[model samples]
Target: MTNTTKTILGLIIAILVVWGIYSILQKSSEPMANEPIKIGFIGPLTGDMATYGETEKNTIEIALEEINQSGELKRKLEVIYEDGKCSGKDAVTAAQKLINIDKVHIILGGLCSTETLGVAPLVESNKVILFSSLSSNPSISQAGDYIFRNSPSDSEFGRADAEFIVSQGIKRVAIITENTDYSQGVREIMKNIFQEKNIDIVADEIFNSGTKDFRTYLTKIKSVNPEAIYINPGGSAAVAGLIPKQIGELGIKNVKIFGNFLLGDKEALSVGGQAMEGIIFSDSKDLTQLSGSLIEKYKSKFEKDPAHDALVAARYDSVYIIKDAIKSCGNDDSDCIKNYLYDMPEYSGMIGSYKFDLNGDLLSEEFVIHKKIVDGVPQVIE
Candidate 1:
């Protein structure tokens, strides 16, 4: 009697185990009705450029809310954020995790050019879409078909900066470049333009990335006694800011200071303080009526203004841009998303109306000169 009972119980247990395995398989095979489409974000959440990352993060959150609320997609969107810390090595690690572990077909970051360039190869090889909201290194244009950026390239930025310098009759200039993809790209293009226009580059100095003390570079720049000094740094607005402040601390007078787009950043303005007064730099001409409205919206929603309105707006647009592509081609098709972006018509958004070229670079953008510390606030000088 005991053997018979034990055998019957064992058979029952086996059947229950098999049924449980079948049920698990069935559940795994069927997609959840409300499953989210996961994407990846690689940016510097804790670095000198952390402000930029933080701003983009907040902007994306706003975009997601708007998109999700509108009910434009079959599934909700979710992001897995990885801090690249504005470092290439860190970005590569983040990219690997996003591509392999998270299995995300789309990524929305690497805000710094260093981070974008770092992850470019991995994304390209793996066929993941890497859409950078703010990285502007010209090299990114050729990174891969799957790579794109909403920000204008430094190629355009360099040309605008160079032309502005020439127009101002600034014949003699000193150029300081922080050795990183973004800064180096701008330096190269600007130098070439300066050479073509017969402008004198009296002192060309290069510094390693993340070098906090720019006093040595400033001293050399002072010694050159150029009519102007162009401060280009790849990492933080702080680097761009500290350079001018140091120039002032060195008593370098009568020199017009110039910088890239970042020179107008709030962090730069705060760090440079009075030293940034009358300093001219290039910025997106797209920062007009539309951007003003977005700024107000951001202020109202977040209870604070974005650090860089144009950049934050572009980050916000990137989310929508990806959203449209995902809607058109579905979330899993990286190739379709790439094609959709490449052939995307001129998209008008908070930043501006623009299209992508074959290389995924913005087809058009305009630059305008800005002066800082005009009555204690930045002013559009041109």
Candidate 2:
């Protein structure tokens, strides 16, 4: 062969070899038949709500591990957790990063309502499906079709609380809540319900979100001699520690105390102890029953019981819900998964039977009333 022709042929062969190698690498890098699915988790990992966020993360991790090991979903699932710090700006930033950088198709959390609201617009604009485990603000679901929550809205619990108190034949009630949106929202609903039922609201008090001294408010509330005191402050761990002591010091043991789901934590139990005994609250599900063997397993694995009770169940169910939706779609196409989720029927989850409504809110009427004891242990009353 001529030298020029030889050179050209050799170059062509090299080009062909390079192209073949590139094609092989591309094919190998593509998603495997049994590749793991990646889901983004955003919540307050390091802030006032960090305990709740960490609890949620732990639950999600355990659920993912179980699902992956069981092969129930038929695909190994992985979750990438981002700390939103329970701030709107942080949440929005985290959502954007999850969408643009990680490219996670489905995102879970922003555990607080304010954070969820801030992140909703970003998730909707990007067409990413966002699920919250504990945000109860009704407006979070109202934002767009992309937003969905496993937790019951505050309104549902608020109404149930009102009913429970009224059922107890308590004619006079006082309202106290934190200044946050979730606390305010629940307080409003309870107040409206009290008005509708013609129950006397002896006193209404609002406290700053991080207020440590609640003696003034509690004392003022005590003066009314209400049959019951409704404290809507969801994250009242700080206040709970002091309120019980002050309530006892004021010689007001007769005034029954009622709390929202926020008072269900171990912190309340640790702080209030016997003083918290007999305090009533409403919950979406009975954690003691719902937790079942999962709690024991979690404690063994993590050296501590799961933080938020049925919240871990909610996180667990979110994975299965996504898996079901993915199976229905039969592909990784975002639009297909989105459509499948919309059409999903009532699924029996660890928390409850979940079926999304027109506004992407889960339609499940499964709440129970409970009371706390010295150990902060919750017992279902009805």
Candidate 3:
């Protein structure tokens, strides 16, 4: 080989060596750009309950964005969402995938109480912390230690509703609930409370969770001629549509309607309209007052105002609580975070003051009674 060619070949080899070392150093010294603390969410992304799921997903996204912007945590927060379809089987499958495939240490969802209950055992056995934002069925908390809920249980809401009913002197009442754990639980609690208050239940009926035709049930309720009707339909959009339409068509003007928090939604307002004019409900917090700047931010991002979906506020607060717990625990260890959550005294959230009890349920004293306005907005009725 010529001397010049030999020199060029040697220089090329040296350059390649230098580049290889540089690449190694770059890869070693710099952390992966995509590294994130993963949290799993399981909800009904594609069913009658999809509205709730979408609200939750949006709230979490907003919370993460704010947290990341603030740079409050050492690790960037990332959420992985799975569609539970509000089904127990789907919830179990989603939970397993989140645990085994995604390797998520913490899960923040399963909107439906049935879904939450279905996944509770698996999550508990795996020692994974599952924080439910909206599943209000009491059995969820009874599932295990690893299962935690930030929202008030159906019992709480039912008691509040019953109190409202008693205050209004509603003696003769009717109940129509969807056939699901949440609706049934609320109905049972409210029934007990009403009985205790000496209120007479004139009509009691159950409808399928996603049923669109509640005419038969409404007709039955009308036939009973109860002074008030308590509709606990498990937040199903179809029921939301049917209830108001049927009630309006049935021309039940004087009858008062009591609803669960699940009925507090845009779709319900749009469909229920004049029929929902005087309907009263017990809710965790007044969304309009509870959500301040967060509501504005949500509106800007989603092009719509946040409605009565408690899951939105709950999910947002859950993220902040997780952040606070992480900060308090001083690490990302699951046990440490769990301990911190249980030990938390009082964390002011959008909803109200949040402090976890021994059972990891948030204790708060700010629930409100709201009555639907003629314009479809809910106004706090003292």
Candidate 4:
């Protein structure tokens, strides 16, 4: 071959090699369409609130299976669960591992208020999206822009409870609160509203968490003989269940028994049995409308009914909400997902339609009163 021809050929080969290298670099920079997107889950898997975590985890399993089967996203979704044990310290640790080690940009977790409150700062600092379904502490409304919860805050619960109390012509009321972030939040809100509405707070009592024997507090509350008592317990379901039993055993009759959302806990109701009967509390609107099949599926798979169907439905919806956010805005883009959720349209799901406000709280939440009846079943009285 001629020298000029050889030089021309060499130039062409060099250009092709460089172009191939550039093309390869471009492809590497872009995300793989089939790569699974990883998300983290934090919950109290082994502590007093373990039922919440177990039920939530099971719900997530069902949701993930459905999502994967539907092929909704370009990539498959994956989750790494870390147990928070219903405490702030453990929740922080779980968040760190999921954030720093797993490198997940979104976390659905910390079912208990303490768990969510504990890791709010960590996730916020890292700009990771934290979504919760069970936490209801009012403080969580201001936790951070990245923090979001579908459950109505305790502020709403307190209002509904207080209103129901007033509507029943209960003038004097007593409050027994567990010393925890969740319970304290409810306590303060109820106290303020009761005073505002001219309802007398006859006996205000405080108890430490995990206090199985609440006869002392119940006796103190009985001495005041308030027409109604608000029992607010934290992660310890036993505290919730036994408090009412103790009250009943103390012969505190002809008095109304009021409680927070925790009163719906299956463990509490089961433990409290007949004593828990007729006790009233406020909760989200009944979700049993569409939960029949889901509950059957849950029972078939786990061989047991979910502890709280409303909460289970919320957790299931949370997975889809996250999926929608990630699909709308590319994966791993926490800011985009956060903004998408903030402006998300009315999402009608198992828990009914709702939207998020600027504070990452539900714009409108429907709270209704429920009464504990036979076999620990919660019947919506209103």
Candidate 5:
């Protein structure tokens, strides 16, 4: 063997040893990937809004597969799901179990406004970050510093719906919604917006959350002869699915029905049949602008079309955002995750660009898409 060859081999060995030590040190600095990263989930798993809950869970499950495959966090993800039932009291209990028993630092859930509000104080005080995909209450802006939602708030929805209504020359309307925070909060905002625009609200029917029959409220609104009827029935198909059929049965004609985003549901179609026709539903712009394989993939896996397509996108994007934050922070430290999110630039997600405003609300814009049921399907009109 020549001396020149031996010297070259020794140099190569020294470089390899140094690089290996650096690699080990880098890995040690990251959070342990062996143990699965646990993130708590709180949403209605069984209720009228249970369908929305299914979409949320399904999207996250799909995202977990992709996230784990990408190996971004170097850890497998494990979620502890607690049913919030889309109500405040139940949400509080779910939060207790998630924070106390599950001991999770990051929470993704509580799709209903009441659900998120119920858990916000508990999680915020404990420094746990609560990121909701669909809770759209405007009051959530001040709910807590740690609270954030990817979907545009009700304030945005209110503005869009109000503008769309007024544009249609609707000088008078009636609002019928449940007493739950989700329905009430959005209704309250739209009511105020309508008043500001000098639009008269002929009747406002607010009822308890569990009322399955709304024929009485519809009857009252019909008598008022308002140009339009706006209803937000909260998160159960029990109430929402009944509106269109009953409204048609009441012989209320010549009055357009404008509803919150929940009215875009497939159950509303299946339940109402031809009766649901011309029932206008307000939706987000991102839903229309979206272009991707998300829907196709969802259809292939779930064996049916998503009841709430926009919601599926929101929940799917949230998982990616959470995974990105976890990878960057190397740990599920609430403070770290919060800081990472606050500092995050606009994330081009499945639905649209996501950038948090100063108040932790999503800065994305929302516009009303006036869609109506046609031949048992919600179709956007010209």
Candidate 6:
């Protein structure tokens, strides 16, 4: 071979090698849509708070369907659902399974406050991201850098409720809080605000999750006959049913009753029946901001009304936010998604436009929507 020919051959080989490596790197950087992106979900799918979890999953599924069908990303998404049972110990077990066994870099939930709090330390240590759907405990603000919740904070929800109650010109109210992070945190905030407004909390009652009977506390409140009764169900959907039933059976009346966000569920009507009627509550939702198409899609897919629960919006928005992060980051560096969300601009979604605060909680444009039960269902009121 001629010397010139040999030089040209070497140049061609070098170019081929460089081109091959470049192609591989590019392919790796942008994962194929066929590849599975595994995300974990830990929530109370089988315990007392199961229905809330079930509802959350419905929204998640709808979000996933829309996302996957859009051809938005190359990688397919898969969710591994684990039953957190709304207990910290159970949540810890579920978290271990998701992180160690399933090898998920991002988790969608630990829906209730207990599960989220339980998994926060582990996920933060393992460099995993946990984004909660409905955990409103204020303590979670200090849980970890990796812990973020889409739902409004307990302080925000509580203050909104307190302000609304005082605005009604009712000076005396009774309060009953369930023993849980969500209920306690919100209860404390409401108490402080009530104190600030000079409104008397005539009777205060605290109950545990499994406490079937609340007659003693209800009897006390009945005697006081406060202008209104404010009850925090503590993330217990079951309590929504039982409490109203007992309140009715006990013949406790002559005052308006109020509830937290959890009372907006249909369980209150199906289980509480006529007893659930006329109860008032405040929640972090401005329904006019929600997409009518999304609501219709949920009804069509699930064969039921979306109930407009804040958790549904929170979880639905969580999916889209993660999808956006993944698309922007383009690699499963986990840290990339964390940084993206840590500095994310206003994300316009089902829950309204949201930006992340330093604590990883969504700085959502959420307001307390005061509701009243008129005809076996909760209706938004002026």
lDDT of 3 by residue, 1-382 (tens): 9999999999999999999989976765554554777789998899777777888889999999999999887778889999999899999999999998777878988888888999989988888888988888977657888878888887788888888888888889999888888888988888898888899999999987557877888888899899988888775654764696689897876888888765666677777766667677767676546677777778889997654455677789899988887767655568888887888878777877778777777687755566665567777676
Off by over 4 Å in 6: 1-34, 248-251, 288-290, 305-309
Worst 10 contiguous positions by lDDT, candidate 5: 283-292
Candidate lDDT values, in order: 0.85, 0.79, 0.80, 0.87, 0.82, 0.83
Question: What is model 3's C-alpha RMSD?
Answer: 8.0
Show the lowest summed lDDT stretch of 10 residues, model 2.
366-375
User: Given candidate 3, what's the lDDT at residue 42?
Assistant: 94
* Candidate 5: tens digits of C-alpha lDDT, residues 1-382: 7999999999999999999989976764565548788899999999777888888888888888888888777678888888998889999999998887667888998888889988988998999999998988888889888888888888887777777889899998998888877777778888888999899999999988777677888888989899998878776655666887888888989998888877777666677667777787778764534535887788889897766788888888888898889888988888988998988999888778868887788886554467776666677766
Encode model 6's per-residue lDDT on 196-290: one tens digit a residue: 98999999899987887888888888898899988898855668777878888888877777888767677656877888888888876764456
For 1-382, candidate 4 gives per-residue lDDT tens digits of 9999999999999999999989976765666778888899999889667787999999999999999999988899999999999889999999999998678899998798888999999999999999999899999999999999988888888778888888899999999998988888988988888889999999898888767888888888889889998888876777778988888898889988888877877778878888888888777878747877787888899998887888888999899999999889867699999999999999988788898988898776564555655557777784
How close to the true structure is residue 93 of candidate 3, measured as C-alpha lDDT?
97
Which runs of model 4 end up more than 4 angstroms from their true locations? 1-31, 372-376
lDDT of 6: 0.83
| Prediction 1 global C-alpha lDDT | 0.85
lDDT of 2 by residue, 169-265 (tens): 9999988888888988888888899899999999999988777777889889888889998877756465755566567777786788888876666
- As a whole number from 0 to 100, the lDDT of residue 362 in candidate 1 is 80
True-vs-predicted CA distance for residue 8, candidate 1, Å: 24
TM-score of each: 0.88, 0.86, 0.86, 0.89, 0.86, 0.85
How far out, in Å, is residue 59 in model 6? Answer: 2.7
- The RMSD of every model to the true structure, in order and in angstroms, is 4.9, 6.8, 8.0, 8.8, 12.7, 10.2
Q: Judge candidate 6 at residue 68 and give its lDDT.
A: 87
* Two-way TM-score contest, 1 vs 3, winner: 1
Better of 1 and 4 by TM-score: 4
Give the candidate number with the greatest lDDT.
Answer: 4
